[model samples]
Target: MAGSLRYRLQPIRKTKMYRYDQYDHLIVKERVAQYRDQVRRRLADELTEEEFLPLRLQNGLYMQRHAYMLRIAVPYGMLSSPQVRMFAHIARKYDRGYGHLTTRQNIQFNWINLEQSPDILAELATVEMHAIQTSGNCIRNTTSDELAGVAADEIIDPRPYAEMIREWSTFHPEFAFLPRKFKIAISGAEQDRAATAVHDIGLHVVKNAEGEVGFRVLVGGGMGRTPIIGSVIREFLPWQHALTYLEAILRVYNQHGRRDNKYKARIKILVKALSAEEFARQVEAEWLDIKDGPATLTAEELQRIAQYFTPPPYETLPATDAGFEGQKTDNKGFANWLKRNVKAHKVSGYAAVILSVKKTGVPPGDITAAQLDFVADLADQYSFGEVRVTHEQNLVLADVKISELFTVWQAVKAQGLATPNIGLLTDIICCPGGDFCSLANAKSIPIAQAIAEKFDNLDFQHDIGDIELNISGCINACGHHHVGNIGILGVDKDGSEWYQVSIGGAQGNNTSIGKIIGPSFSAQQMPVVIERLLNVYVQQRTEEELFIDTVQRLGIAPFKEFVYASPIPTGYTHGEDACVY
Candidate 1:
């Protein structure tokens, strides 16, 4: 209690966010104490490196290429201003002066010291945060849309359901160890902003014709060594049975999933090997046993969880703000930011704003301690002290008033957080790659930077239109290259880094994996290869067609031809399997 963190500042008004209860506090505090002892024993040479590896991993501490990495979970991407300030504190005091926001809706301190991990956890505990289940063979963070409660197109607020799943999965005895790591994503919006299709378990909130709410469940979809889109196992699962149904699926996976090979251990492989129909049948049989068990959610229980996600208090105002429109009309930069970064909100006078972390030179999701602190200040002033971390590695102020758009834009621009390229080609989703991760085959950040530099012009990026370009340093697909409109995968060929290019991949309602254009390219050739692919798209695209639309219409044939049309530049050979001209 002596070192407990106290909130010295508060938001102007009450906002919807999950608050910690006594049980949550007890669990986190106990885990911290246990982990502290584990660290002590390891330091005293009682536990070997091999013995401490899994223990540290379970607490979200990884020994990376350079140093120990501490991953702190931000459940469903929700972050209070106070929590963010604590992140800044950790970044400044424990790790480097910056922290990286990961695609899993978690934050990572890549330069952490092994001995300071328990201290870091202790600091996070004060803010009601932890790193549990962030690693190891278990269910990782349950992510959802950043604009969950505020999205205009939302069917239902997904935070409650996501929170419920988080509660059920955390420290479950049966799932303490699984065949491999599992990921789950839920989206209630008509547009699948959460990229649920490529998760182990994808839950889409839907309403039946009878006006009953339920989930459309998809299983076994993931992007990794073997990228496959998930198949829908259930058309409609009643909300009450969500947990029981999830338990059934996990049980089926736990029993049948492969253990001999780590590569083949994910539920996706099992679902694919057994076929979706067979897997569905197995899950259904398992579900029947616990159909109406104690896990069944009641109306009262739903309300209790749902109340935490209720919309914040809002003042009555017209949908359009005249002054905001006039400012946008006068300033081209502000207009572009408004068009690209701002999204419609459920409330008439409110909007959801994406603060771009994809600045041209910066790593895709890296934010400095100063920026984090500034964002906390901004959140307190403009967005009710709440910020959301997007799965695409951006931050969001979910409840900004429409009239305050210009002020928010100005403040964020001064902080280098306003890049005005949310959905553009330059707005890339990239992994830390060989720069940090021991598993990475190549450096992903440089490739992203190369592409961003080549296409540095804002006008050019805007002209090219909305495109999702994802880069992964390895086949692990942490950057989710398999689902990008244009996917770039870093590979090792003959002990050198090469990139494999894919096109036509997409997330959302019509999720599909990208097709390999032809062969892998050298790191130097990645930018050129992307340019050629874009050239094909620009030349062949019909009126107003997006890059993905053009790829779908023309297929990979045209793009492939253009990429390989020219002779291989001197001194460079495609991989061993490539057809060298």
Candidate 2:
């Protein structure tokens, strides 16, 4: 261990850790042992790569171009300070000192050795966390609104339902060997922060007219080769019948979902082929048998689960703190941070603060281990020792006091997390494109970086206000490009990276897929095209108009003309002269 050579040859160390309960510890220990055995068998050539693929993927291990990548699930995007510290520790110890927060609300550490994966999983389990079901055909992490428990608009905290789904789906016997991976998201608030509409199954917890709590279920929304908005299968499914109804939906899909063609295998395709009405009828028919059966949730069981997610005792504090007002009046930066990052919390004194990971010239959602530790400390100090990961790939301090806003802003700014660009043009949602993903047709991170760099001015971003610029590596739409106000899809044109642009997409209540404006642009021309598109909106829009609203009114024609009329030379043509910059 004295010399560098000796250090390099040192055996990897496994550390024992603590958890809240015996079941948590026991499960993690068993899982580690199981995975270690799996790894040993694979290395010994007993398990073929094909056989080992699903096993590894289930444990959140991916064999990438250079090495293994491990995705750690942040269940419902909720994390304690200690859990986050453990994440930082793992990132620093096992892999590079950085982690990527994925759109699915998980953190992925690249450069993990195959040998070290079991140890990592062991470490994660100590914090009541694991990589299980992070990937593969079984239900993935049951995501919910990031501000689930704390949001003022919330009818009910969706975390309890999410956790129920998580447990039920963990080792679901029948649905485990499905045709493709399934994703489900739940939201309880009026504002659909969970992007439930775009998920395989979107559950919206609501109170029906009869004063009964139930879910308005939407099924078949996905963003792979064919992106489709989920269709509403049930306008109102009784709370007690949640599981039985879901089982019915899954059973129908498993039986009839396409298995012949991988591209056409998603539930979305099935829904389309059968039509939403027919699919709904089939699911209803299947549910009739299972309704009021063992799968039906009892009030006691629901209450028992709800107990775990009960809100922490929050003291009544003043709505406006003098200190916060003074700081905002004194410091312009603090005021800007308050304006952009802080969201209203249900409690009087508390505010939800969005930590923008979208810094200029950096890949969005990429945070260093040191930064993770810094955020964990901030969460402990200012917030209530909790952090939430947003679907848009941002971190949120869900319970910061108004009195501590300035202090929180200072700490965040020091760590480069206070970009004051949340929901702005610079805050791009992008995927790990050609750099890491084998499926990508073109590079997405670079395009995101380029846009961020191009629109560095905070004032300019503010003027361009609330624009969602989403980029995908391919048509698979991992970055949710289809729902962005301005969408960019990467395409391969004779081997070069070309980007197709779309406009008028929105993911909120008025959700719609973006319409393609015209022919694709070279990577170099994308920024210019986006700029021109924005310029057209700025020139033509009425006061306080958003990007989508402008596009909806003018249609894609104006934007298309502006984009293609002066196409950049060396970029694809729409049969028009290149516009002079």
Tens digit per residue, CA lDDT, model 1, 229-254? 99999999999998889999999999
**Per-residue lDDT of model 2, residues 305-412, tens digit only:** 666666665678999877778889999888888889889898898899999999887799999889999999887777767888988999999888888888888888
Error of 2 at 137 (Å): 1.2
lDDT of each: 0.90, 0.83
Error of 2 at 367 (Å): 0.6
* Inter-residue clash pairs, candidate 1: none
Model 2: how far residue 261 lies from native, Å:
1.2
The stretch of ten residues in a row with the least summed lDDT in candidate 1 is 1-10
TM-score for each prediction?
A: 0.95, 0.94
